[model samples]
Target: MDIGILLLGVAVLIGAVVVSATGGDRKIARLDRRLARVEQKLDAIAANLGVDLPEPELATVKALLAEGKKIQAVRAYREATGADLKEAADAVERLGG
Candidate 1:
């Protein structure tokens, strides 16, 4: 009878932990969505204000640099953000090239 009670307590504890973990995951997912929305709004506002945005998410630029295409990367950055050659080169340099 004592063993049965102990096992039951352990089961309850495990159930509570699982429930808490799943709750945390849901909260994190919700926060991620909110963050993405905010970022989109901010990017739009920045564009209207003629502020150049970073291109860490510019996959093609990253790929170009990775494939030994610094010039192409600079061009891509320029095209994407309407940056000047010097600004584009600086941006590409921050990509570790």
Candidate 2:
């Protein structure tokens, strides 16, 4: 029946969308790994050149830390720097200390 064919078409379309989304996720993961490697290399180069990378100055984050709002500081750092949660938390802790 036509209904069966329509159902099959819809199923195929859904499958295609899922496949594409999965592929995109894999590509993003690969890119993230590549970017991390590049960052490592850049850090090494900077170290060899005796270049001290200046820490980013985030006034809001600093103020939050000073006020004993550690969680807010971490969240602000992550928002400003696009860093992961763990990285933001660690950075906030260091700044607080």
Candidate 3:
């Protein structure tokens, strides 16, 4: 009886781990998609604005977009240009090129 209980406990623990891991993976995937969408928007904005940024900062912004951190990316761009969200996103869109 004791051995059966121990086995059951282990099985439960394994199940819990799997569930948590799957949940985390799903969240990460959702975030990735969101970032991609946001990046596309920024790229469009940048192209319309006809602006360019250094490759390094542009790369960082791209990574931030992929990570679903648009607000952060916008803030960074705003700091550099003293621009608001719309302007900053537009600048980013141009930079995406």
Best by lDDT: 2
lDDT of 1 at 81: 83
Q: Model 1 residue 15 lDDT? A: 100
Which digits, one per residue and each the tens of the lDDT, describe model 3 over residues 42-78? 9899988996655434556667777878777777777
Q: What are the lDDT figures for the candidates, one per model? A: 0.91, 0.92, 0.80
Cα misplacement distance, residue 30 of candidate 1 (Å) = 0.6
Candidate 1: pairs in clash: none
lDDT of 2 by residue, 18-85 (tens): 99999999999999999999999999999999999777679999999889998889989999888999
> Model 3 Cα displacement at 30 (Å)?
0.4
4-95, model 1: which lDDT tens digit per residue? 99999999999999999999999999999999999999989999999995644578899999999999999998888889999999989998
Quote the positional error of residue 15 for candidate 1 in Å.
0.2
Worst 10 residues of 2 by lDDT: 88-97
What is the lDDT for 33 in model 3? 100
Which candidate has the top score in TM-score? 2
